[model samples]
Target: MGWLHSLFSPLKKLWFRMHSTTQNKGRGIYILYEDVKSCPYEDVHVLWSILVESNSASLPSKK
Candidate 1:
């Protein structure tokens, strides 16, 4: 494997570990490697929605 991939592989595993636990159950979305980096034009909107939703969920709610 290339050095760059070797570097990212561990990070990806760590991300999955953090998000796939019971604490985050039902709140995680998994995308295949190919689909994420080279997503088709038709699927761009889907990716955008996921990003927006993740960001919104991370923000604190106003009183």
Candidate 2:
């Protein structure tokens, strides 16, 4: 597996680093590998919308 893996590890790491930040960036998203038991997509979406609305409300209005 060493030779087969060596050629791909760097590429995998580079891709992961490049595109993985969105999965978790402290805004309000998370990846639960384990069983979450709660907070399904709908719930998360509602929460996300709420946060966005609150944030937008806090911002000054534009003409």
Candidate 3:
């Protein structure tokens, strides 16, 4: 029911946050590329580009 979802959603999120593994608690990003050997070069390039751009934007510039 909708009411049940509303009641439990926050609790579920809290539970996961409290119980998450060490690997899931960091600021690191994890990308899963299944069948990496067969993945297209363009796909990898695009992902790399987005990550680079986002990281650069988030970093503070030095004067």
Candidate 4:
């Protein structure tokens, strides 16, 4: 499974970085906003994926 782990390693790192960066500081909302504003284009897809995943997971499912 080494290849599988390697395949996901970058995504895992991105998630950890985003999570830790936001959580470690006070005023997370403002910090996240600033980070997004300054974030590089290459990282935007990863950020968007994280947002979509979290948002969908948090919402209640329709019956």
Q: What is the C-alpha RMSD of each candidate to the true structure, in Å?
A: 13.1, 8.9, 7.8, 13.1
Q: What stretches of model 2 exceed 4 Å from their correct place?
A: 1-40
TM per prediction: 0.35, 0.35, 0.36, 0.38
Model 3: per-residue lDDT, tens digit, 1-63? 999999999999988877786556442444343434346788886787787699899999999
Error of 3 at 9 (Å): 46
Better of 1 and 3 by TM-score: 3
Q: Which candidate is the best by TM-score?
A: 4
lDDT of 1 by residue, 1-63 (tens): 699999999999999898778555544444443456577675876777788799899999999
Against the correct fold, how does model 4 do in TM-score?
0.38
lDDT of each: 0.74, 0.68, 0.71, 0.82
- Where does candidate 4 stray beyond 4 Å? 27-63
Which pairs of residues collide in model 1? none
Candidates 3 and 4: which is better by TM-score? 4
The candidate 2 region of ten consecutive residues with least summed lDDT is: 28-37
Off by over 4 Å in 1: 1-40
lDDT tens readout by residue for model 4, 21-57: 8767757656776777777786885886698699799
Which residue pairs clash within candidate 2?
none
Candidate 2 is scored at a TM of 0.35
